[model samples]
Target: MSEHFEPPEGGNKKVALLIAVLALMLALAEIGGKQAENEAVAKNIEASNLWSFFQAKTIRSTTLSTAADAMEIDLAAATDAAMRERMQKRIDDWKKTVARYDSEPSTNEGRKELTVRAKAAEHERDNLKARNENFEIASGLLQIGIVVASASIITGVVILAFVGGGLGALALGFMGLAMFAPHLLF
Candidate 1:
């Protein structure tokens, strides 16, 4: 006796279509992840630079303050009138410079201004990091979906295909949320 078998109707085609859709979703997720990663890196660099600037300003302010204090001590012990007069003038100039470093809007480069800028940059960096994390999660889910969908195509299991589709849909939702409001997820 001879036996013959016919492939299930439309099963292969359906699985192929599912796989194609999943592949597309995976591609989009990958792109979003890359973009988010780049943004996070750029924001981190900017925050780091702002912090460095703030540190430099703090150092300058501290040096000026120390100089003023030392001049005060020297002036108290000075015997020469001319030397005391010069020291007093230098102390006054140092005090003014220190005050300007604390809060000078005209220069917009004071310690106060630098602190504000550094804080703002850190906030932005944190937001970007959240977005990047969401994107990474989305990408991983999409990758899993693509692999599962491909397996379904190979094994001819319709249930596996549905599971893959569900994962893909979830990934798409995360990607959209990351693009719109990443802070909500965080």
Candidate 2:
């Protein structure tokens, strides 16, 4: 059998509107929250990869420097001109490599450049986390506002509807901050 229902003859339609508006805001907040969460995770992974690259470069440069220094000592003591020349050449090459590793601004993959990149990624991750937190808060408030507005329908209390509307507005304010001015402190 099919059931047919009807709205109460004197129900407050404003409560339904409040519930609908809050539900819409809740959906927006959920979308923003998920997007911020995904982006934050990506930025975190980028920062981690950059930092690992920086460490690898540092280790390589240090090992090269130690080898070059040892080669320099051997070069000074070598009696054969040919051996001394070869050792000197190797030392020079290692020095150039170390310098490049320390700061290859053009490629932006050197230790110094990697540090800057990693820090910027971390900053972006932190900002996204904060935005996600605001969105979560907005979602919670909007959900609660929807529930309260529904309750107003059952209780026929106009004040409850006003409270629900206020909560919805507050949630929207948080969503606004998350979307437009996330860096601003509440």
Candidate 3:
């Protein structure tokens, strides 16, 4: 296939323009889709890491709480006042550490804070996924529009150009929705 792609003489030139415009739109759609997909993947990884940290914090808090309870039980059987006092103080320290792990608002590294952060990341990933899907659909429609517009030039079927133009217009709407109103686009 060594044929040159020269434009046909006369009226069909408009269809060639339509094909060019549709191809440009397809490129834009693909770019947006790829960006959204990449962001979604990053957000997903962030959420996963946050959840794992939250789980580790939860385990540490539980272990500390259990140890504090056991120490308090052992302290009751101690006859020496000094030993009982030391054991009570150590148990109090462990209880405070367990509370800090459960909800340390200042550090934002506690189990409760991590849970909130992970949920937020998950929400962002979901929205990005929806936007990517819309862009993908727009890209497909624009590609088809380009094909149809090219066919109109070859077959001299003027009506095919209008159909292709309609498809391109629809694709534009999808692209706009993906950018501005992704929730609605999804």
Report the Cα lDDT for candidate 2: 0.90
- How high is the lDDT of residue 80 in model 3? 96
Residue lDDT tens for model 3, 16-105: 788888999999999999999999999999999999999898899889999998998899899999999999999999999998998999
Clash total of candidate 2: 0
RMSD of 1: 2.8
What ranges in model 2 sit over 4 Å off?
Answer: 1-11
lDDT per residue (tens digit) for residues 69-172 in model 1: 99899899999999999999999999898888787888777878877877887787777777777778887887888788777767766778888889989988
RMSD of 3: 4.2
**Per-candidate total of colliding backbone pairs:** 0, 0, 0
Model 1 Cα displacement at 123 (Å)? 1.6
Off by over 4 Å in 1: 1-11, 78-82
Give lDDT tens digits, candidate 2, residues 1-186.
995544456556767877888898899999999999999999999999999999999999999999999999888889999888889999999999999999999999989899999999999998898899889999999998988889878777667788889999999889988988777863
Clashing pairs in 2: none
> Which consecutive 10 residues in model 2 have the weakest lDDT in total?
3-12
Q: For each candidate, what TM-score against the reference? A: 0.83, 0.92, 0.92
Q: Provide the RMSD of all predictions against the true structure, rounded to 1 decimal.
A: 2.8, 4.7, 4.2
Candidates ranked by lDDT, best first? Answer: 3, 2, 1
Model 2: how far residue 140 lies from native, Å: 0.6
Best by lDDT: 3
Error of 1 at 33 (Å): 1.7
